[model samples]
Target: MNLETDLGGIKLADPVVMASGTFGYGFGYEGLIGPGDVGAIITKATTREPWAGNPPPRIAETPCGMLNAIGLENPGVEVFLSEYLPRLRKSGAVVIVNIAGRTFEEYVELASMIGTAKGVRGIELNISCPNVDMGGMQLGTSPDMVYKIVDSVKQVTHLPVMPKLSPNVTDIVEIAKAAESAGADAISMINTVQGMAVDIETKRPILGNVFGGLSGPAIKPIALRMVYQVYQAVDVPILGGGGIMSAKDAIEFLLVGAKAVSVGTGTFINPRLAMEIKAGIEDYMARHGHTGLHEIIGAAIL
Candidate 1:
């Protein structure tokens, strides 16, 4: 079966992508996955300036998943260009640079910067960050904000602009529609559900941030539902992901109209998770006699 897929204009060797922040710019997985092991590697979130991330106790184990408020920690886009992106290209991995910024201008700046880089296949805008200029509202929570950010970034770069949608909203479909209207090349759905965990011992929050994004098996159903809804509403390709721990989970996302799947928390348990997910997808296709992803993508929607 043909697993090759196109996310925006970026062609992926397979449908499985190494989600951002899970691989840390693809350097940690050189020993685990060789060249072309996965479709694409989304680098950790890059900002205009280096971020120290949240305070300690940023990650905590939950019932069937995990909670994390890493706060988009990274060494800044300058370092990524001088170091990480080059090494990722040499490793033969298709790279999608995920970028975040403090203000609207910062987002555009990062887009222009990465667009000039050598091997970046596409750009995933991290809109889940607080809009400090807008009174700390998440840029993704407001449909207008989503449209504004995507529309502005699209003007600065020729690279594919994909806004990663946040789940912490009243209506995710509206947010996605706004992105599409703003000329987003593609859409990345369900950027972790808002959640928190408290310690009965200290009678305080387990994470220093008090709240974190939830991931793992616990959110897969919610992710799938949201992806299905957004797929029906938008015409652009969808990169669906959240708590996908196995091939079946990834397949579920495909059936619901996700053109591709991004594996994040699952990778933390197994560094080579993308390769295994790819192999499992190939196996499923052969067993089911499906010729290509088109047969599986959105097949269950009807």
Candidate 2:
């Protein structure tokens, strides 16, 4: 079976990719699985300057899912370019860097930097991170903001640009179409849903940020629905993910119109989840006599 596919101009060996944040800099789980075993590696969200992140209790476990307000903690772009970029390039895998910034200028700067950086194949603009006070989902909620940010970044970079969409919006299709119209090569859907947990006994909030993004099986149905909606709204490819824990779950995303599927919280549950899902897709393809992934992508629409 041919699992290879293209996300805009970037070529992926398969549709299974490790979501940003959960995969670190793309080398954290190197020993567990070979770089060639999966399609691409999306590194953690990096900012222009280093962020210390939130205070204590950044992560809390809830029923069937988890809540986190990690606040986009990272060593910043300079550290990543100087230290991590070279190592990831040597891994012989396609590397897609996920970037977030506090301002429009920072976003453009980050894109321009990564666009010329070696070993990077694509850029995933993280406009929907719900954990931070500035940037993140703030820039994602407004369709106008989405268009401007994406357009600015596109002007500076030739690499495939994907604006990750926020499910927190009233109409996700509007934002997806905005990104597409602004020259986004592709779009990724369903960043963690905004949620909160309470310590009823102590009458306190569980996370230090009070509210956090909810991820895991709890948000799968909602994510799938959004992907389907965005598929019909935009002409660009869709990278779909939310609470995908198994190959079957990934297939469900594919059926709904995702050109690729990202494994986020699922990686925490199983480090080898991406590889397992890749193998499972291959098996399913062989059994059903499907020659390539394109056969099942958006097959559910009819």
Candidate 3:
């Protein structure tokens, strides 16, 4: 039952964590998986101010995946701290706040705020969000920008910083290395692939934003490949995501060197998916006579 893992200095009871955005704030899914059941609760992407998000048709179903343009509609950092943080502290889970900022100073400010917050475990920088108007795609796609953003936030906070990477990049390895060199404690990646859907009948785009990022089974292979390449390029821990619906999905990430696996679109399909994946991983380790999850990290390459 050694599912425990480490993300820099933060230790987790397991390698399964709920991905930001998909899990909403920490309070919504507590009924399905207790705060302690999974390794960590990565909250929704919060901005410096409240966002109304995009108009209707924010989400649309795809074959094996889904596209969304939720636009990071959050209650703002002040509201989150004044309201959400108090309830999250009691959930019995490690609170990892996922934050996005329009500029370098904003990110630094957000990180510093979270560092002083009592219940926060770490900060997962949501640098890959394409649906937002600010620094999501703008900062994540370029290695230099990624480095600069990570550097700015690292200077302000002592808490572990996990820079989430975008899949819509020419070279993920390059971005991963940039984040590592810029002082990122860990890197979470393959946020979403840029995509669009159209309604044949109306002869119009499906989502309000016209283009949304894709998630779910369709992007798993791409996510794994990025994580594997990133693992080879840097020594920092990697949090791999993008379509992990089952334990087998999670194992694929571990085998490729992900320190932990984050559940995204899968939670929409099954709220208890993280718990099921955790149990499945345990069952797998027992049957194979492998006693710990760490043993599987990068094992496939060996």
TM-score for each predicted model, relative to the true structure: 0.98, 0.96, 0.96
Please list the Cα RMSD from the true structure of every candidate, rounded to 1 decimal place.
Answer: 0.9, 1.8, 1.9
Q: Alpha-carbon error at 13 in model 1, in Å?
A: 1.0
In order, the Cα lDDT scores of the candidates are 0.91, 0.91, 0.88
At residue 223, candidate 1 shows an lDDT of: 91
Per-residue error for 48 in candidate 2, Å, reads 0.5
lDDT (tens digit, per residue) of candidate 1 on 208-288: 899999988899988999999999999999999999998999999999999999999998888888889888999999999
Stretches off by above 4 angstroms in model 3 are 129-137
How many clashes does each candidate structure show, in the order listed? 1, 0, 0
Q: Candidate 2's residue-wise lDDT over 189-220, tens digit each?
A: 88999999999999999999998999999999
Screening candidate 2 with a backbone cut-off below 3 angstroms (N, C-alpha, C), the clashing residue pairs are none
**99: Cα error in model 2, Å:** 0.4
Off by over 4 Å in 2: 129-137
Leading candidate by TM-score: 1
What does candidate 1 score on TM? 0.98
